[model samples]
Target: MSGGGTSPDYVFAPHERPLLPGSPATPAHPTSRRFAYFAIGVFVGLTGGFGNAMVTTNLANIQGSLGLYSDQAAWLTAAYLMTNVSMSLLLVKFRQQFGLVTFARIFLPAYVLVTAAHLVAHSYTTALIVRGASGIAASALSTLCLLYIIQAMPAPWRLKGIVLGIGIPQLATPLARLLSSDLLERGQWTVLYVFELGLALISAALVMLLRLPPSERMKAFEPLDFLTFALYAPGVALLCGVLAQGRILWWTEAPWLGYAACAAIVLIAAALLIEHNRANPLLNTRWLASRDILRFALVATSVRILLSEQSYGAIGLLTALGVGNDQLIMLGLVMVLATIAGLAASAITIDPANLGRPIFWSVALIAVGAFIDSHATNLTRPQNMYFSQALIAFAAVFFMGPTLLIGILRALVKGPNHIVSFVALFSITQSIGGLAGTAFLGTFQVMREKFHSHSIVQSLTLADPQVAGRIQSLGGAYGKVLGDPSLRQAEGAALLSQQVTREANVLAFNDIFLLVTVLSLAVLVWIGIRQLRMYITGVNPMSEVLAAMARTRGQ
Candidate 1:
């Protein structure tokens, strides 16, 4: 029960007391309830991830169905991230001020309505509005999943639930890839939204039926918080716009990209300047700028960036070479299984005492996977990629739990105030890191493809006898249908040109693989060196933090 408005404090039984202002209490549940909570968590986690996952993995189909240009389709994704990223800054405080149950009651039903609206949203503008609303509403889903999982697990393993809950949403990507083909076959882009709406309805009903225990409320929102957000939200939205559209619009070719970048910098800088001086800031500027937090953000962002080897490298290569999602069902299954295994392995083997080790292995696995993929030829198929993609998928989920737990522990050791900062920092790293990875990798692939295309095209001329023979052989395939000699020759030349383009794309992808490999190895060495230095100096960075937590828990 909350105290009067003066104290902003509460008194409750230890078991019923919330760990934080916005979070639900950890009161023990009956066995059946725990099982129910676990099941709900799994479903909720998948539900949280699937909506955006479908849009991303099936963007091509959605683009065609909506008759949207590539730039326009990209905005669907940009809109989601734009609203999703900055909303966390407010959502955390909303729970603290209003209580999570009320937070859920409001957002969950709103999310369902927004998802249902997605079904009738045929126009691009309406779809964009729906996506923005979905982003704002769906921001609550991750918290719901984590809360449910925390309730499912007992106290000692409570941190384990946090890790699993954080990682569980990742399973949606592979699952979406596995299922999107069939969903697309069922209907148009709206069909995917139908599936999403169904999942949302299920999750919302579950949450309503099994509401979380009451949480303590506090007057957490400051008047300046809104002012800070006004500056921060637009800054982040602009950055998301640039990253989401830069590669589509071609960064240097678009003047607005430069303008957006400059505007984003100014806006973000102004917000940080305001927060840096505030006694009670929305974002903890000093804590986030600390050495340990900075390192945590870097390691977390680095792994997320490297994880793009699967999405941009393998999937992009396959798409370029005309491989369909239908053909990659088996590969998607492999990835789904690998991701589950990684989630289990990370949860099982997690040593809170040494969170960095799992991250090390994750980066190592990513390096090996990328190196193997670097050898890819035009002959590479989904089957050719099964093992490599599995490695990256496993690494992607594997790194998440430890990386998350590490920052979470550090925040807990500091104080409850820092938890908000850590959560916001973590969310930004993940959302922006993912967008940056796709944007950077896509840009790199495009540039490399042009170079390879130029080199390959320079060598092909009618003067070469082999070239002449291949063109004649290609043109012969059209001979039966075409009566004119010149037309047949022209068609054959066109086919040859297409083949050259495909080969160049393959080469470009291989370069991307190598690029990720190099980056992974570099991150590995950097982290390894720091780890070794800590060992040699007998200075474990997390030991004091963990001991502090252990002492707190013991009391």
Candidate 2:
């Protein structure tokens, strides 16, 4: 089917298509042979998603042992997120030029190399850098698997296969978490990477054995607009920097940090202008001009970011309440239950075309759950924590299907850059939302800690006349709570202090949760306002521009 290629007919046309659908599909081979290849693709995609969690869980251990601080350690995540998003676009272009098999061949080895690099990284810098590189390769696994499935299956089964492809990887979360626990128990996190490296090799071997249809092969390749990337990089770096240090940066202030943020904004503004003017711009300015897409992007991005930051809050609260590593591992296990629940729900009502109402309702549930979590007064009970976490996870299942993504893509299919533009904007919004949530919530936590600590100290009676006189007589014995001559008296003071500190920590965490509750509520309010406006005016921010394009084409 490729016009310019000089390759032989057997190589290009492949004399025979597989017989997966039976009869016509089995003209050359049995139905089982075709299903087997699809099964292998599913396995590869599922493992890749699991590998994402494996790498993330181990990052803490790897950084801690290597003495990496927040500044250096931030890249471990930034690199992965950036490469994953950017590489999504890159894969689109590559698939246009080379076959899916060839791209898979290239990506799998790179992922394996990254896993290997993690195993041998001697210093913090090397490990951080290598982890970032590995993300690019690992991120491609799911997208490629989708493309493979879409090409292999006949039309009627393609949607079912796509749904299966996406669903399988999500199920990998619990398994990945399980592996993470085992790896952490053995000391260093590098072992997780070593395991993943072996897995990637197996994936690569499987790819070699799979047979796919020719039309699904990539059509052509295009070079990236480096100028656009140059602008995007600084924005990404600045945003990541803020998220990593925002707790210390003091929200929107803190001189140096604010300056970095300002610079990033300026750079992005310039990129927008440059791209809008260029004939073949990196971003599709015309599509962005659409009001609906803008609104959906903002709302979706906001919800995702808030949800992501909530993860940090949940983990922090767990630690504050003295949940041990083993307990946390158990908590993570509960999340798997959520994943299973999500899968089951998706199986029952998983239409990609009609996801808007479901997504809206899911966000509402998540907001309510966040409110419940905020008001949690008792941390001693595992049931309380489990209930809150499970609720959020259940809510997430409604929000995180390919339906919304498919909606957005269909909404923008008539735009100049199509998927590439959709992806770039999607990535940018997600990154920003995540950073804002994390930084805002983190700083809120720190400030709450300070405020609550002072409040608790003031509530104590340490300055009472009786206490003062006892301290004076003891000649600073209270300071040496453990080693004092009057051990009984010192122990009493120590106990009093511990009680005060415990109250203070609880109050601080409570305040932080309240702030999160308010934020989530605010998001709901914002969405409600926008939705009301759209409903009143019959203005769909998602499809307005796409609708215009359709009208123009018809005329």
Candidate 3:
């Protein structure tokens, strides 16, 4: 099982909150007031989601204006994502040591400054630096929102809140895309960040007004084992970097890249083992061994792989087909349907009984839809393209709603420690999965094209009488069009080469779709086997919450 970030569901724990030395300990509020606070957190988190997605969709335009190449332009997105994923764990200790109020107070100002920096960012290097710092604050704030929501809401409502909190980001993509035109029309992507900063200001106001229960607060942190966390950070960074770069750097021969990746993984694993044996570990690995969290991590890994393929792959395919900016906006806009569907699905199904069913079916839809999308090269047929895009959107609704619900349920079952680890591990794995899938698929497309070209060329270079006559005839036609006797041979060769390239491209794309199908099927089989084994053992995975207390004690 993957162990990464804290589970927001752990906020529901009834432990008394500890206060900072000078900070006032706030009394717990009535359920009504607490729910109101939870709502505010959702609003702030959703706002961030909207801004984050807008920045992602607008990356291409940002690169064009800033003069960054494809790989360099990627740093903006990668930096933000990496910071968010890596630093979340750090906040867990800080939130405990400083108190939520104090942490928010610190992050708020930094957030404003970073947002402003992005607005006036002049170079790729500068923008990434600014984004990296801003991302740290954003990550802390988001985790705070999750922690607060879990603390404020009742147990029954906690899972749904987490689901909505997570779902908001997924839903925002389409909405942001729909609004991309108006934002882009205003010149530069600065306008989006301005809106984000405004939202942050609003969140700051809400945070000030709404007081949290002392019971929900964290205890003062002891001195961290920096030696251990230090090991984990670079390890995670390298592992993700290698996966992200492997496809780009040709996998094996990019300087010290491969060696560094191996070393990082080895070091990180060793450190984790060392930390796990320590009295106060960076991660609570003992709690992580519980069946629920471990199984949840496995499921999350699969879901992430699918999500990576869908989001990154879909975006690249759409852009590659020469889709207009307006169309791209509309394409993303369709996700609202899925988000709404997820929300509705959550409302009807709260008990853990039917949760896994939706997850299974949704993943199936994602696999099938993505596989179809891989074969989506008939861009001239608008109907066909829309059909493919719609299927993907619909599948996303199924995939996201169910998977998110299951994750929240798992977090609820596992508690804060496991939740944190799960999220951290989830982020790390999903990032790796997406980068790996895109790179592999991209390289596969290239390789397929080369093979198709060779075979088709060999077929074209005929010593056979019939093939030779056809080639000569094509040369004659080319001579007629150019009316230049000397240039006829070269023109005929160029025409044949163009035709071969086009055919090769189509075949390569088809192979990508076939591979996606195989991936989806493999996921189903894996999940199915696990479920069958659980059934045979007569142990409900969701039932592990009953033993969570036992697991904690053993740890």
Candidate 4:
């Protein structure tokens, strides 16, 4: 745990040695203090996640209030991600140099102020800025949540705290969907922001009341660091923008997407080129380009993509069937509980000897859940999806902890400098993977819907007996309301067409579900093959890193 031989330039204080090598000191607490720390850790973690969750879940309503178009409203989310994904690159260094107390003192108030600004800002531009700032604050809060949770636990159980801290945020989307109906019903959009502001104030108060122990400080920032950040931050932001808005604007149709994408490539390449030549690089490109790290990123990104089964496919299907958040409250509750269960299961059964096993099982569960959902019809409701969605939900939380631990162990073994690279790699893979998944699935859904619609329309000839009978039956209902025979017939035909469209949408969603099932199965097979090969070779990728982590934790 001594910061002696690995990196002589940076040293750890005695109290900080138990924590990450370059992290702030976290003193072990008594039992009562540990309980309090756990409570605050949960609160702050949920708060950080809930802020973005509320906004994302209620985007349509927020758009209506702001009088912005769908594409413009999407920018709000894009803005949040723009800063959120990029800030991790520098925030680690900020804490290393300035101390955790200083990091909290500045960012917590900024988060509160941004929440307030969101309430009062009537214009889209101002709101976008506020959201961007909130994203930066959120990244900081996530770090704080991990640190506080680590402090809450006894040494051996500390890794479990990390698992819970990371997994808790995944609950926000389901929690937001469950709570948003009541918030909107009681006080409209402003009420949601008010609730978020209250949480921020409480988090700020808790942090100030019981501060993290201070750590050794040094001049962690260098001129080259800012140079790399300046180039890299906006490059990632533009890439995020492209992913967020590509579907809305229709990829090939938007000219700016091409320009933005080109600019992003140039800027990111320039940043990496600068980092490559520096004596002390901000991002350790060599480590990131390693085979194991690349594989980890690929697996993580693939899982995120497959997770769109719940986020896009099932939800899109329900929305098409006239199900709303109000009707899905029970479903959300089921998912939240299932997620908590998964987190517990993962913590209890996490095997450092074989980290890939849980991930394998999680993907298998996703495939099962998606295959189950592929059988839905017009009669399908949120209640019908409870079990399948719960399986997916369980798998979602179950996989994340071990996936993260694998990377963390690897980074720890390498040295503290590689931590920044791992963080950046993780954030980009997750954020971009989500955006890519939604865009890909959504576009596929649209294309299938069109094809299905055309096929259904072609078969509905007036000459067919069943089609004629159905039209007549529909017209009969309108006969009592309309005196004109022709008008009633026209109305009935319109109704029949509407039904055809609805059925087409249902069929398209079924195709989407089947696609997810196939993709999940493919990923599972790939991972299984890799695991089998490793087993035959008698190689465990995590052994060295886990040994290193265990040694550090023991100190």
Q: After superposition, which runs of candidate 1 have C-alpha atoms over 4 Å from their true positions?
A: 1-12, 550-555
Model 4 alpha-carbon drift over 4 Å, by segment: 1-18, 548-555
Highest-TM-score candidate: 1
lDDT of 1 by residue, 239-290 (tens): 9999999998999999999999999999999998898999988888998999
Quality of model 2 by C-alpha lDDT: 0.61
Q: Which ranges of candidate 3 are over 4 A from the true structure?
A: 1-39, 144-155, 209-215, 218-220, 286-295, 353-355, 380-419, 456-503, 533-537, 547-555
TM-score of each: 0.97, 0.81, 0.80, 0.95
Give the CA lDDT, 0 to 100, for residue 242 in model 2: 61
The CA lDDT of each predicted structure is 0.89, 0.61, 0.63, 0.86
For model 4, state the Cα shift of residue 484 in Å.
2.5
lDDT of 4 at 273: 96
lDDT of 4 by residue, 1-555 (tens): 121112454444464453453364555669987888788888888889987899888887899999999899989988999999999999988877776767888989998998888898778889999999999999988888887787787767777877888888888889999998999999879899999999999999988877665555666788999989999999999998988888889889999999999999999999999988887788988888899999999999999999998988998899889888889799989999999999899888878778899999999999999999999999999999999999999999999988888887798887777788899998887888887888888888988999999999998898999988888889889877898988877888999999998999999999999999999999999999989998999877788677777786676
Winner on lDDT (2 vs 3): 3
Which lDDT tens digits does candidate 2 get at residues 341-441?
76567545655444455566666766666666666553444456776777666655556554445434454446424666776666566545665676766
TM-score of 2: 0.81
In model 4, residue pairs whose N, Cα or C atoms come closer than 3 Å (at least 3 residues apart or on different chains), thus clashing, are none
Q: Return the TM-score for candidate 4, rounded to 2 decimals.
A: 0.95
Q: How should the candidates be ordered by lDDT, best one leading?
A: 1, 4, 3, 2
RMSD of 2: 5.7
